[model samples]
Target chain A: MTETTLLTFLQWIDLVGVLFNAVLGAVIGRAARLDVVGLVVLAIMSGLGGGMIRDVMLQSGPPIAITDWRYITAALLGALIVMIVRVEGRLWDRIYPPIDALALGTWAAAGSLKTLEAGFGVLPALMLGTITAVGGGFVRDMVLRRIPGVLGGNTLYATAALAASLVAVGSWYLHVPTIGSIAATAVGAALVLLARWRRLSLPVG
Target chain B: MTETTLLTFLQWIDLVGVLFNAVLGAVIGRAARLDVVGLVVLAIMSGLGGGMIRDVMLQSGPPIAITDWRYITAALLGALIVMIVRVEGRLWDRIYPPIDALALGTWAAAGSLKTLEAGFGVLPALMLGTITAVGGGFVRDMVLRRIPGVLGGNTLYATAALAASLVAVGSWYLHVPTIGSIAATAVGAALVLLARWRRLSLPVG
Candidate 1:
């Protein structure tokens, strides 16, 4: 594929990631029995909070989520769809984790690329990328009065984001082709899924 | 007083505010039974998180908190003092609220001034100012698994910050002299203390 096509595909991946995270946020809001305003707030925060932090850290003008109406619309639409459909029960329980992993990897890769493009060093880029992938969920869980999944005994969620970010940043630093970066993202997402499937967790003292 | 004297005084207010907030954060961390790392993290977040957010939104370069080693040192010192002193019992309980209010007003004023200097409009300046005052506490409370004191019933804390921010931003917008801005900050701080003394609060629905 052309370079333009590769970039477009990556953009699509980011959009999908945003939507998936928004849905997950809405679900958490529902479980918390929050009002509509709370649900919407959670949706937006979970969908874009990390990217907003990244953009601000980079001093990259107004965050894209704040500027682009499409992103806001997408997040709100995800919340609305979940609210209307009420997608709970066994089916959702089975599918949610995998989708969440996909979103995490995609966002991590996207965040690292943005940071790299803005000329930050690799370590900062990797850190920001991991933050971008996990920030929204952290805020959501905090609001719900729970320890953030990343910090607590959840599956290796943040570790997955970090892994994806490292791969993406490594490829960029090596001047690998864009397609190679895309493959790295996939590898990261797969690792998250594998960790989840095997019930892997970081040990706590 | 000379212009240099006035600037130095304002800087002192900011330093005092950071120290007060850091101590409060350390106290909370102690209550939560967090380790030394957690205590220090809470202290830094409570002291500098709001300013970092404000600077980022203003598209300023690296946050002053990150660039200035003095700020970091101040926050760490606050945390260490709390750890060593363990100021609990009646004395701490009585003194803590007033100092916390003082910090809130000072931070609110400082945040408003920075926004005005960055050429933002009055409304954004006011909003960012209020955010800067309360953002640290919000992060701390979130980490501790509780509703943010600003959002929940907490003795009109956020309201006081907003009031202080409004006065400060209004003075700046009116092109008042620096002394006038200083007086405005005083009035804001006085209002917070008055609210606390009178046990005033916004009514919950």
Candidate 2:
């Protein structure tokens, strides 16, 4: 298939992932008691903040939103859905781990794809993929005046995404087919599950 | 005075301003129920976010901490002082406005100084100054899962910094004396004061 076709396919998947994270962000915002404007702001940040950072690093302007209206639309849809459901009570915290897992994997994939399309080398691609997966949430935490979840040893959270990004880089490097990258993502997800269930961690230096 | 003297003088003032703001950030963090780690994180975010973003936009890496430790030192000192002061209880919300003003003015000055040192043109220099002032807060807001105060309809918060930056830029373009930048910073502060008092706003497009 043409690079364009592959690129377009990747973009579509990223769209889904962004919206999923945005919804989760909105839920978190509501739990925090932020108003509507705050909700949209957080949703947008979750959906696009990392990509924006990545694009800026790559010297691209406007990043996610400038590319298309699709990202914004997806974030809006997800946020609306989350709010309309009016999920209440304390169980919402439990839902976080799962949503986080989904966002990490998909965003890693999107980051790798975009970086490659932008003609970056494998190293930059992998690095950016890690940033894309974790950067948004990290920014979200910092904005809320909290320590970044990744840095604070939240379930080997950043490592899971980093594993996926590295695998994607390796997959592309070896000229492997789509399944190689898929397998890599699965490996990442499996690690997250193991880490969460077992409460695992790498010793802090 | 020599260029080094001027630069050193500016850095000293900038350091003083950032240090106090960092303290303010920590105070707020503690008030918001964050632990030690959270307080440090917020202090750093409030102190360095703008300059870091500016560096990233200009493709500079690691920023202040990556090279000199002055910024970090200031941040730590700020946190330490705040912890010592134990500022809390009533009227905590009132602190935001004043702290915001101080940060805005300081960053505007720093941006202008850095831009002129780099020999950028008037427009970019002014913009860089403004960015230096508010970019950190914007990043902090995004991380905290909220809209940046700058992007919101807040009381011309960023605009005052922008005005200062523009004055610095224009003064340089017109070949004014070094003290012109000081005047520019004052102008920016005055604008912020006017806005806070009169609740001025540029109509949203």
Report RMSD for candidate 1. 6.3
- Candidate 1 chain A weakest ten by summed lDDT: A147-156
Q: Relative to the true structure, how large is the alpha-carbon lDDT of every model?
A: 0.78, 0.70
True-structure lDDT of candidate 1: 0.78
Best prediction by TM-score = 1
lDDT of 1 by residue, B1-205 (tens): 8867886787777777888888888877777666554566678779888888888777768676745556767887888988789678899888777667777777888888888898888888889889888998888887887778889666777888888888887777677636644765676677777777887777876
- Local accuracy of candidate 1 as per-residue lDDT tens digits, A51-111: 8877777786778898988778878987997889977889888877777777788788888
- Native interface contact recovery, model 2: 0.09
> Which pairs clash in model 1?
none
Give the Å shift of residue B29 in candidate 1. Answer: 5.9
Q: Write the per-residue lDDT of candidate 2 for residues B1-205, one digit (tens) a residue.
A: 8767765765676776678667766775665555454566667777776787777755544355323557767877777777676665566457655655755766786687677767666677777888888876676566555677788687786889988787777767677635656666677778887898898988877
lDDT of 2: 0.70
Residue A73 shift from truth in candidate 1, angstroms: 3.5
Interface Cα RMSD of candidate 2: 8.3
